[model samples]
Target: MKVKAIRVHKIGGPEVLTWEEVEIGEPSEGEIRIKNKAIGVNYVDIYYRTGLHQEPLPFVPGKEAVGVVSAVGPGVTGIEVGDVVGYADTPMGTYTEEQIIPATLAIPIPPSVDHITAASVLLKGMTTYVLVKQAFKIQAGHTVLVHAAAGGVGSLLCQWANALGATVIGTVSTQEKAIQAAEDGCHHVIIYTEEDFVAQVAEITSRKGVHVVYDAVGKDTFKGSMECLMPRGCMISYGQCSGRPDPVPVSDLASKSLILGRPGMRHYTATRDELLHAAGEVFAGVAAGVLRVRVNHVYPLHEAARAHADLEARRTSGSVVLLPAMPAADS
Candidate 1:
């Protein structure tokens, strides 16, 4: 079948993303064909599209989506046509209306969770779970600092950390996003545009500093994030939206005896059981109203170029979802 998708032949700016028809074949052994219901827009997708991440020439660039299984190929089990499933951190090529994915990557979506919600949160929510539960182990009384806290993964981090009884301090670029961060459970929101975040975190923590700093902003915020960490604190650098940060010298970390981790969902949930465990927690959090997905940005899949542009400009907050475009009316 020929379907509409965003394809990248050469990496560059958002303009490189082309909405065109691509042919898809039936799934082979151990693979399932998915007719996508909704797709996620993430910073990682931008990375691949911008050459920050390397890939073979000519490819579809997307990592998360929720869909219905339309065909189950040979050797597949426990999944069938008509089942609603969601997958994140999978092999790229989910930018289209339909795709073929490994059976092992599929996670059953609960009936209570809507497709858009599932698409928006799976990748980001799992990343948040790993950051809080595995990377640093947030606790009650622990002070947490989340950079880009108005963002997709950042918002979930704020909410989850707060629910875990931590004092959450978040940083955003604008006052509007600061308000959004506050509503996401940030006890204190810092508009980095007006105030120095390092100074603000120092004041918020009574000069003691935070136990952990979630710094995804990279080049611009990395050094500042390090300064905001308490001695023996943890720093989780999972992204580089602005640009890659300079490598830290051992002596720098020695000054504070700090622990640094760069955890990715792929490593945290490499096994099937691990994937299910992380995904299960995320879904449960949503069902319990603990993780509020701010699907604040929604666009048709064909408008992906515009979506990328808006995301890179920081005009989007929380989760950004791309729905499959409607079929053109017969003319």
Candidate 2:
């Protein structure tokens, strides 16, 4: 079958995202073919497109999507045709109308969650789950500082941490986003563009600093994020949205007794059991109303280039998704 998708022919700007038709054959053993309903647009997708994360040329750029199984390959068990399923942290090529994915990677989406919500949250939600639950083990009375608080993962992190009885201080680039962060459960929202986040964190935490700093804006905020942490505090730098963080000196950690970690979702969800456990926590949070999946932007699959531009320019607030089955009028 031939499927429409956004293929990256070269590593460059959003223009490199080219809409093309690609042929796909039947899934081999232990694989299932899915017809995508909605596709996720994430900063990692931008990294892949801009060569920040190296990849083979002329490959699909998406990493997450939600769809329905149209055909199940031989030896696949527990998943039948027509099951609503979603997958994240998988290999690229999810930018298509249909795809063949390993059955182990395809997870069953709860019937209560629609395709758009599932696609928007699966990757970001799972990442937030691992960060707050596994990486830092946020608990009552803990204080957390989340950079880019209005973003997909940041917003979820703020809400989840707050619900866990932690004090949440978030940083944003604009006043509008500050308001958004506050609504997302941030007790204190610092406009980083207009103020120094490190100074603000000092004042907010009464100079003791936070228990942890969740930083995704790398180069621009790395030093300040370290300053916002208390002694023996953990700094989780999971992404380099601004740019890769500057190398840290080992002596720096010794000064404050701080611990620095760079975690990846792949490692957090390496085993099948780990994948299900993390994903289950995310779903439970959403179901229990502690975590809300906000899909602030939606675009047609073919307009992926425009979507990337919007996301990179910081025009988007929460999760952004692409609808593969969008009608011509919407496009």
Candidate 3:
């Protein structure tokens, strides 16, 4: 069937995200068809759009969404028609009304969570889960620093870290974002554009620095992020919204015996059990109110380009979700 979807024929600016018609087949064996209720908009989608994370000449950019099982293929069990499920793993083309995804990738959404809320948190929340739990194992009394603390993943990080009993320090460019970060559980909110973050971190930690620094802003924050860490601390560089970070000398890490990791969801959730555990934790967190997901922006699927532009400009906070522009012809 033909569906109205966003396609990138050439990698460039947000302008390259084209709303066009594409044909997709029904789910084959071990796959299921999803009539998407809400699609997730992430910064990583921008990476794919601009070719910073390269794909083929034409491709779909989004990685996650919450949808209903419209059709179940042969041999697909554990899920059936009418079930509400969410997925953050591959088949990479979610900026559409419907998609066929591997059954294994689908995680059922609890009744307490709405489609928009599930779409908002599935990917970002799971990443936060791994970063805090597996990446460094944040604990009570630990000091944590989060770069872009008001961003999609950043907001979740601050809240989750705080819930883990860490004192959260967040850095943002504007006073507005600082407020948001603080509300999300940052004990200290630094307006990086107006103040020096490294110095502020020193003051916040009494010059001892943080136990872990989550730097997603990439190049601009990378060097300073390392400085914000205490001896033997972990630096989790998961994203590069500013640009790829410059290479580091061995001495930079040797000085403090620092640990650096650049983790991706694919790396942490490669196995079925791992994926379910991570996503399950996020869903449970949301249900129990440990994770307060913020769906601050909602755009119709056709206007994803505008969504991308706002995201790149840092004009958006919390999480963003996309609703289908119109219903499927079959529906």
Candidate 4:
């Protein structure tokens, strides 16, 4: 079968994302060929397109997707043809209508969920899953501050943190986004553009700062996020959407006995077992309604450029996905 995919031929602007027809090959041993229904578009995709997280050029440019298995190769014991599966991985080929995925990375998608939601949660949802469940082990009554409260990671973080009984202080750039963040699970939404987040957190916590700060905004919010934390509190810098934060002086951590971390989904889900474990929690979170995946916008597979443009300009408020093609068959 022929598949249409968005490829980045050169490293530069969104215009570099080109739609091209490619041949779909059979899965090799231990692999499954998937007919992708939904492909996720996230801020990380923008970083790849702009050469921020450098990759070998002229390849497919996405890491998350959900689809039905069209075929399975030998030695793949856990998966079979016709299974609903999804993955978030390093190959960066999920932008295609169909892809050959290693069975190790493919997790069975429960029938309770739809493809769009599955794709939306695969990476970001899993990140939040690991962050709350493993990274800092959020507990009841802990106070947390989440930067970019309406972005992909931020939205998921708010929901998971609140469900874990943490009081969430989410920071957003505008009133509309602040409202959206509150709807997601933020106990308190701070419009960082209009007010000072550090002062707000200080007031909200009655001078006893939060236990942790989930900061993906990086350069713009790092210092402020750190200040919002209590003594020995953790600051998890997982992404650089606002550009990478500058180097910190180690002396800074000494004053607070701070626990600084830079966690990545890749690190959290490095082994197949870890991937399955995290995917299971993510899947259960979605199925149980404890977590919500919001697709704020979707673009045709060929419109990846416009999609990247929208995300980079901060026009998108929640998770975004790319519909590779209309679903042709149900699994």
lDDT by candidate, in order shown = 0.94, 0.93, 0.92, 0.88
Q: Candidate 3: misplaced stretches above 4 Å?
A: 325-331
Which candidate, 1 or 3, has the higher TM-score? 1
Colliding pairs, model 2: none
Q: Candidate 2 lDDT, tens digit per residue, 1-331?
A: 8989899998999998999999999989999999999999889999999999988888998999999999999999999999999999887888999999999998789999999999989999999988998888999999999999999999999999999999999999998999989999999999999999999999988999999999999999999999998999999998999999889998999988999988889899999899888888888888999988889999999999999999999999999999987856764
lDDT of 1 at 300: 88
Cα lDDT tens digits, model 1, 18-129, are 9999999999999999999999999999999989999898999999999999999999999999999999987898899899999999999999999999999999999999
In terms of lDDT, the best-performing candidate is: 1
2 versus 3: better lDDT goes to: 2
**Model 1: worst 10 consecutive residues (lDDT sum):** 320-329
TM-score of 4: 0.95
**lDDT (10s digit) by residue, model 4, range 7-113:** 88889989999999988889988888999899988788878888888888788889999999999998889787889999896668889989997888888888888
Please report, as a residue range, the 10-residue window in candidate 3 with the lowest summed lDDT. 322-331
For candidate 3, give the lDDT of residue 10.
94
Candidate 1, superposed: residue stretches over 4 Å from native:
326-331
